[model samples]
Each structure stands twice: as structure tokens, then as C-alpha cells.
Target: MSGTRATADLAARYRVAVEADDPRVLIPLYDPGALLDVHVPHWRFQVEGRRPIAEQVCVLPRPGRFTTFDGEATRDGLLVRFEWRQNGPTGDALVRQLHAWRLRDGRITEHLVFCAGVWDRELQQRMAVEAPLVRP
Candidate 1:
């Protein structure tokens, strides 16, 4: 398969893993020494190796919590935009994030997450309209 097609396939599978909320399913998608860089508005850190990456994935909000996942193949990786919702004491909250992954030999070598902060309802609606989610 061509590199673009391959990455698109990988991106689809990655979305499946995320929606499944199963670390076991997600772990194999990464290289043994994979690097995950997490960058939010307030915090930034890196997780190295599959073990830690799996651990991080395990702690994410469960399946169905994420409302949408839109992705496309990049020259060297995949770029996925995700919208997630959570119910808290206050009320329902939404978060929007972008994830970029670099794959090598069909496994992810580098993954980066970017998010500004929790998104308000108006912003979420605008984003949903502007960048509607698409499956592979």
C-alpha cells in the first residue's frame, strides 16, 4: 500500500482503539520505545516507551466519553482532532484536542497531543461544523 493509505489505515485503527478504551488494543499500535508528548494549556510532559504510553491510554476518559474523532493522513503521520465530553459536579463539560502521530514500520514512533483547554458549548458547536468528524 502507499504511505498515505497505510497511515490512513493506521489512523482508523487508532481511533478504534481510543473509542474502545482498551489499552491492550492501543498498545500494539506503538513502537516499543515510542514517545508521547502531551501539551495542554497548562501542562506539558513526555512519556517514553510503550509501557508508559499504555498506562496513559488506560487512564483516559472511557469510551463514549469522546463524542467525535476526525482524522487525516499527513505526509509523515496522522492528524486527529477529537472532542470529548465529561459529566462533573458542575455539569457536562467538553474538551477538544488535536493529536499528531508519526508512524514507522506501521507503528507509532511519536505522538503529540495539543489542547488549549476545556471548550465552551459555542466553540464546540463551531468546531463541529467547521471540522466535522470523518472516519477513515
Candidate 2:
């Protein structure tokens, strides 16, 4: 269970977990001892173990809607990306991110994530208008 097929499977499970907002839905994909490394702006931190990692990673911290994109397999893992859309105290916002996952025996042993900071709806629209995506 490696390569593109495995990556696809991981995406399906991840998407299901996110949509269900259930950490339990994501636990099975993780090893008993798994690590979640997160990077945002100039800061970085980690969450350890399947339960804790699943708990933190399964859903957005605050109220929000999100869209999951397709994942691609790397030599030892897969890259999973998504967008978070939220309406906060200020207004509508967006955050984009991707996770680089390492799997073995069909279970995730670790994953690293880099986040694109949150942007208000206005900035999102401006970026959309000004920046033509070279690739989706």
C-alpha cells in the first residue's frame, strides 16, 4: 500500500475525518506513536501520538469550512493540501496549508505541515484578481 494508490487512500480518509469533524475517524490511519509537525509563519511546533495528533489534526481549531485538494505521493510519503474558509470576528477569512505525510504499513508515522497565514476575504479577493495561478 504505497505510491499513488496509498496517497489516494490517505486523502479519502483525511477528507472523511475533516468532514465528519471526528478525530476517531483519523486515528486508524496513524501509528500508535505518530508525530504531527506544524509550521506557520516563523513558528513551528509538534503534536505527538496517534490520539493527540488525531485530536489536533482532525478538525479546524475554530469554526470554519474547508476544502481538501488531491494528494500526491512522495518517495516516502504523500503531500496533502487544503484550504480553510472561516467567518471570524472580523469577517470572512482563508488559510491554505499542506501536510507532508510519512507512512509505513499503511499507517502514518509522522507528518509535517507548512501553513499560509490567514487572510481576510478582501485580501483573498485581491490576490485572486491580481495573481493568476500558474498551476492549480
Candidate 3:
């Protein structure tokens, strides 16, 4: 497949993984040596290898609906911006994130995600104010 088509396939596969409620579906999307940079609120997990990454995703508590994913295929790779609202049995919350994935040989070689606290606090505060009003 062409690069654009491949990237689109990867994006579609990711959505399928979420919809299937099976993180194991993500396995084929990455290389054995793929690197994952996961940034969250209280901690950051910089993981390498398919098994470890798969394990982490498997253990993740089902965060609520991923409301939207807007993506573009770039010269370097693909950039996916996601808007999510988490409503588990325990709590409810919202988050906006950007993921940059570098693909090689049709698999994700490097994946970096920017989540809460990664950007300016003021910008986050502004987003917090505006996000609820804007429909996903």
C-alpha cells in the first residue's frame, strides 16, 4: 500500500482496537522493537517492545468513549488528535491528546503521545473551560 493508505489503515485499525475492546488487536500495528511514549497525569511510561506495551494496554481500565480522532499523514509520520471522555464505573472525566507515530515497514516504530500537563498550564486551563461547550 501507499504511505497514505497505510497510515489510514493504521488509524482505522486503532479505532477498531478500541471498538473491539481488545488491546491485543494493537499488537500487529507495531514492530517488535517499537517504542511507546505514553504520557498521563501522574506518570509517564516510556516502553519498548511489543509484549510490554501490549501488557500495559491490556491492564488499562476501560476509559470511556473516545469521542473523536482527527488525523493527518505527515512527511515524518502520522499525527492523531484525540478527544476522549472517560466514564468508568468509578469516575468521569475528559481529555484531549495528540499522538505522533513514526511508521517504518508499515508498523509503528516510534509513538509519542502528549497528554495532560505536557503543555502550558494556561492553555490547559483554557481548554478545560472551552472543551465542554464544544461538541466532540
Candidate 4:
């Protein structure tokens, strides 16, 4: 498959993955030897091989609905930026992030996630004023 087709397929895959909350659709979307490099303030997981990555994602505890917006795609890859509102046991938290993807042969070979921490100080301050009850 061409890069363009791969890019288009990625967007569709994400939609199916999130909407169905099924890792099945997502797992096959990547190359057999794909790599997923995820970085956060406290944790870094450089998962290699599609099976492991899919398993990891499958274990992700679902808190609430996930929404994706402001998506863009190119011949090289696809970019999916979105906000996810997770209603945890304690309260609800909103996290926004931009996902940079690299597709090869209609499959995602590499993926990097840039997280916009929702629990940041600035967000807390804004939440305190806007929605105190939900603010942590």
C-alpha cells in the first residue's frame, strides 16, 4: 500500500479503535515488527513488536469516552490530536494529546505520543476558577 493509503487507513483505524474500545482493530493496524515509543513525565515505554504494543493498549483501563479532533495526515504519516475525558473513580480528568504516526506499507511501523498533561499547574489553576468541584 502507498503512504497515502496507509495514512487514510490510520485515521479510520483510530476511529474504530476508540469507538469500539476494542484493541482488536488496533492491533492489526500496525506492522508485525512495529515499535511504539511513549513518553510521559514519569514513565517511558519503548515497546517493540506489534503484539506487545497491542497487549499493552488492551490492558489500558477504560475510564470514559475518548474524543479525537484536529487530525491531519500526510504522505509520510498521520497526526491525530484530541482530548480525552476520563471519568476515574475519584473524578473526571481531561487530557489532550497529539499522536504522531509513521506508516509503512499500509501499516503503522512507528508511533510517538506527545501528551499535553491535563493535571498541569496551569490547568489546575484554571480549573479551580472554572470548575472547582472537579479540580484536583
Candidate 5:
């Protein structure tokens, strides 16, 4: 557990943990009674406890591997914004997410997430042609 928390970069920890597909790597990063509040579209759900949060995070059906992740540390905690996508013949599914985590005692006590929902290649193409973004 200490091994996982040795580094101060939380986003690096996440990249390692997710890439390794190891939930144990994140268990120590959260408080025993950690809270996770997730919001997607018009839906919201909550999960409590470190073990549950760790497990839940690992099982999330992200589009695929993360495309990008950026973390901004704040006085109380930090915010991580990232995207996931899988480009292949099957389809190119993309999902965007943001997480605001409050840390204390080197462990996260609260985590709030906002998900933009999933978009397949078709939808992505339509949106791109219909409404092009001036900025990425």
C-alpha cells in the first residue's frame, strides 16, 4: 500500500494502476470511508468506502485505454480531466470525464466525477461535421 502512495503524482499513479489493471494499486489512495459521486447526462450515483471505490473504478467500461489525462492540483485537492477512446474496425468509441478529488492525510476523502457520456464513431463523425469545434 505504501509502495503505491510513495509518489506524489496522483495522475501518474492512476496511469500506472489502470494500465496495470490493478485495483490494489489504488486502494491505499483513498480513505476508508471515501465517497465517490458520479454524474452522467441526467443520472447520478454514489459509492462509498475505499475498497468499493477502488473496485468500482476498475470495473468501469471506459471506451478503451485513456487517450489523455491532465491533473491540476489545488489547495484542498486536485482535478483530473481525461478522455478515453478505442479506434479500430469495430468502432471508435470516445468518452470524456473529469474528476475532482479532495485529499487529506495523503488519501482521497471525496471524489466527484462528471462524465460527458459515450459516443461511438458514427455519432462522433456526425457531431464533427455538424458542429466543428474551434478549439480542442
Candidate 6:
């Protein structure tokens, strides 16, 4: 398959795994020594290796929440953006993020995530936060 097609397919599978809340499904998609860099409002860290990445995925919100996922293939990777909504202390909380993955030999080598802060119902609709990193 073409690189673009492969990247798109892999990205779609990644989205499916995330929506299903099953990190195990993404194991085969990553390189053994893959690196994941996560940057969110409250936390910033890096996880290396597929095992750690999977563990990180497991901690994310599972089913029962509302999510919208969109992905596209870049020259050497994939760019995916998603928004999630779930119950919160005051009302519904919303989270939005952009995930960029660099794939080699059909496996992801580097994954970077840029996230917006969790926002309450009203704030979520009114706030506009741009992603810190642009596609390179």
C-alpha cells in the first residue's frame, strides 16, 4: 500500500482502539521502543516502549463518554484530533487533543499529544485554545 494509505489505515485503527478503551489493541501498531510524549494542561511526561504506552492508554476514559475522532495521513505519519465529553464535578467536562504519530515500517516510532485543559460546560463552548505545536 501507499504510505499515505497505510498511515490513514493505522490511524483509523488507533482511533477505534481508543474509542473502545482497549489499549491492548494498539500494541501491534507501535514499535517495541516507541516513544510517546504527552502534554496536557495539568501534566507533561514522556513514556517509552510499547508496554508503557499501553499502560498510559489504559488510564484514559473508557466507554460511556461521548467522543469525536478525526485523522489524516501526513508525509511520514498521521495527525489525529479528537474531542471527548464526560461527567464532571459541576457539569459535563470536555477535553480536546491532537495526536501526531511518526511511523516506520508500519509501526509508530514517536507519538506526540497536545491537549487543551478540561473545561466545564460553559467554558468549553467559549474557550479557544490553539495547539502548541504545529505539524512539522
Which candidate number would show the highest TM-score if scored against the true structure?
5
Query: Local distance difference test, per candidate?
Result: 0.78, 0.81, 0.75, 0.70, 0.80, 0.78
TM-score of each: 0.75, 0.81, 0.76, 0.74, 0.87, 0.79
Q: Point out the higher-scoring one by lDDT: 1 or 5.
A: 5
Higher-TM-score candidate among 5 and 6?
5
lDDT of 4: 0.70
Q: Which stretches of model 1 miss by more than 4 angstroms?
A: 87-90, 119-136
| Candidate 6 backbone collisions, by pair | none
18-132: candidate 5 lDDT, tens digit per residue: 6566889989889898999999999999999888888777654543688788787777788888887876667888888899988887778999989998888889999999999
Better of 4 and 5 by TM-score: 5
Q: What TM-score would candidate 2 get against the native?
A: 0.81
Worst 10 residues of 2 by lDDT: 59-68
For 33-53, candidate 6 gives per-residue lDDT tens digits of: 999999988789999999789
lDDT of 5 at 48: 97
Report how far residue 125 has shifted in candidate 3, in Å.
Answer: 12
Predicted candidate 2 versus true structure: per-residue lDDT over 1-136, tens digit per residue: 5367767987888877876688888888898888999998889999998888888775464567775566778888888888877766868877789889998888899889889888888888898899967885
Question: Where does model 5 exceed 4 Å of error?
Answer: 1-8, 88-90
- Which is superior by TM-score, 1 or 2? 2
